[model samples]
Target chain A: MEGSDKFFVVVIVMSIIFTGLGTYLFLIDRKLSRIEKKLKEFRGSKNNDK
Target chain B: MIKSMWWKFLGLALVLYSIIAGLLIDVPALPVIHQTIRNLFYHVSMWFAMFVMLGTSLVYSIRYLSGFRMRDDLMASGAVYTGIFFGLMGLMTGMIWAKFTWGDFWTNDPQLNGAAVSMMAYLAYAVLRGSIDEVAMRARISAVYNIFAFMLLVIFLGVLPRLADSSLHPGKGGNTSTMEGLDMTMRMVFYPAALGWILIACWLLQLHTRRRALIQGIH
Candidate 1:
């Protein structure tokens, strides 16, 4: 394969890998935010009982 | 700790720059390496970020040992997790680079073996953390182990490999390919790539720690 062509392949593969990893991170962040919100609401309700 | 988003944005921007620049920038077309030299920005930077994360883990481990705080323990564990992730990525990328350049996916080089050993040592720490049932005992014992393992990691990855008579890796055994000798064009992207990766790893550590804290708080 030509040198520049090999590099282009690398660039595409790397971009895909990074994009996938970034998307996974974003999903995890969203899940954490949902869990945190639920916990806050639960705590607020418990405080209201007192 | 998650209040500000400036550092996260900076990390993202720097990494984006590295990705684009690393590809388009001109590089020294050395024999055998040629375009594969661009792996320097990705593979080497992963190790750099891993070291930073593991160093942070060591500091938090020390703090946990001294203060016995659960938060410090959590931070130390989170950092280790992130560091291990980077280490694995570094190994995978290095192997792929090596396959192209060195004609094999693995080598008998001292540097490669040392890196594998160091990673295994950290994995043992993770297993150690899992075995103990009591929270306080697990934290205290694992904190001590983390400090010991990190010291070994430094020696394995940094010092011992350099002392070897021969190494396939550059910048070792008195080789001239050290970072100081890197072309200015490459350094322009390399430094930022390393720093950006470290920042992103820290961001991941913060997120991991926060999730752990929230879960613990609920329990």
Candidate 2:
């Protein structure tokens, strides 16, 4: 392959990898935030009884 | 958060727009760039959406710091996460366009570097939030860091790209392109794509925030 073509392939690969990583992080952020909210609500109710 | 009717309306509009942009508009073909122009619909739209989200989130962060309210913190978090989504969309679409137009995937160019830096800063925001366990303390610290991050994002995305000496993309460093060769149909498609994607971003953020509230209320 020509140098430019090889470079293009590399760039595409990097883009795919980074895009995947970003998507994964986006999912994790939502999941963790939900968990945090649940814990907060639980603590809030517990404190209300006391 | 928006109601279900909001999404239904937005979805219908998107579908109609797709038909108009694709079939009704006689978009000029850039043979050199091939299908790269298609990426414009996604890439440019996402950048604008990201900017809006980050700006909104920064506002909430400041409010949280001033008042120490939990709702502000939640809003700030919502904006940040949505901003990250738009950022990813922009990067992915840009990469595809770069591959065809530049005959390579990566250019080590100014715009690319700026975008990469902004993404890293946002990632750091998440990490910074994670490091602090106490709600009040976390919100305050993250707000301070977010202010710095917003400054960096503005500089990287808006200022540096224009002021720098080198770049691959067009409209870099004070140079603007006129619609010298663009046809009417291209304009129609381009305008709607930009507007439609922005609406979609806003709509998604509302849905996400509502879902969070619902889950919070139920448990």
Candidate 3:
């Protein structure tokens, strides 16, 4: 590959990596939010019992 | 502590700047490496980030040893997992850069071998964790093992490479320091790129530990 073409390839690889990382972070954030909500509900029910 | 968003945004902004400036900024022209030097920001930064993540793990492991808190153990493992993720990125990006510059996908260079060894050591930690069933025992044993593994990491990746007689990778016995070729212009983008990735790694570690905490209810 020409020099410019190789640079482009590197750029594409970086972009793909960035996308994968962003997607993973977003999914994990969503999962944690769900878990926090559930924990809050559980605590609220326990408080009601008291 | 992870609730703050400012640092996360700062990490994102710095990374964006590095990506842009790294690509567009004029780099020193040298034989063999040429423009591939631009990879300094992306490829090398991954290793930097990995180092910080593992360092964080080391701190948490020591904390676990002192207090024997299961939560500290969990956070330690979380940092390890995150460090491994960044290490994988570093490995892949290094492979790509190697193919283009060194004309090989993999080489027998000391630094490369050291990195591979360090990664396997951490992976073994994961496997070690899987073997135990009891909670406290798992935490205690893994915390001790984590410290050992980190020491191995430092020896392999940092010490052995410098002790080697010769290596294609920089910072070896004969080679100049890793930052030697990075002229002032390149340093502008490089430092922030590294710091940005380190912050991003911390953010990922926070998310990882938060998920682990919620599932295990240790926190």
Candidate 4:
């Protein structure tokens, strides 16, 4: 491959990797937010019962 | 602590910018490095992020020792886990860059060996954390070990490598420091890339810590 072609290939590969990683972290963040909301609701209900 | 999402957006934006700029920007077409020099923004940034994460872990470990808070212990563990992830990424990227530039995936360079040793030390820290069954004992013992291991990491990555007679890695021996070698354009992307990766790692750590907290609360 030509030098510019190789560099562009690297750019595509790196973009894919970075985008994939960012998406994974976004999913994890969303999951944690859901779990946290559930925990807060459970605690609030328990406090109301008391 | 993970409530604010603005920093997360900022981190993602900066990283995306770095990815685009690092590739397209003109770089010094030095002998042996050429286009592969762009790996500096990616690979070296991973190590910088790792150091930040590890340093944060050490601070939390010290706090856990002093106050014995479960939250601090969780933060410490989460930081270490994230730090190790970055370290592994750094090593993998380094190996690929080395293969292209240095003609081998692995070499006998002091910096490389020191990095390997430092990673092994952290892995041992993880194993140590896993071995104990008691919560309080595990936290206390692991906190102490984390502090010691972090010191070892500094020595291995920072002190020992520079002390070597020669190294293929830049900024060691007679080679110019990595910062000294970069031009203004590369430096602009490089600094932001490092900061972005560090922020992203911290975000991951915050997520891990929150998950642990939720699990503990459920129990």
Q: Rank the candidates by DockQ, best first.
A: 4, 1, 3, 2
Best model per TM-score:
4
* Candidate 2 residue pairs in backbone clash: B162-B173
lDDT of 4 by residue, B1-219 (tens): 455788997898789889988888888879999888888989999998988988999999999999998889999988989999999999999999999899999999987887788789889989998999999999999999999887876766666666788877776774536687678998999999999988898888888888888878732
Task: In angstroms, give how far residue B12 of model 2 lies from its true place.
Answer: 5.1
Q: What does candidate 1 score on TM?
A: 0.86
Q: Encode model 2's per-residue lDDT on A1-50: one tens digit a residue.
A: 12443544554554466456445644654665676677788889999999
User: Candidates' lDDT values, in order?
Assistant: 0.85, 0.70, 0.84, 0.86
For model 2, what is the alpha-carbon lDDT of residue B107? Answer: 81
Candidate 2 residue-wise lDDT, B71-185, digit = tens: 7777788888999999988888888778878877778888788778888998899999999998778888999999988886776677776777867666555864523466666
Model 2 chain B: weakest 10-residue lDDT segment is B18-27
User: Can you write out model 3's per-residue Cα lDDT over B75-97, one digit (the tens) per residue?
Assistant: 89999999999999999999999
By summed lDDT, which 10 consecutive residues of candidate 4 chain A come out lowest?
A: A1-10
- Please tell me which predicted candidate would have the highest DockQ against the true structure: 4
| lDDT (Cα, tens digit) per residue for candidate 1, span B96-157 | 99999999999989878977887898899899999999999999999999998888766666
* Cα RMSD for candidates in order: 3.3, 8.7, 3.7, 3.0
Worst 10 residues of 1 chain A by lDDT: A1-10
RMSD of 1: 3.3
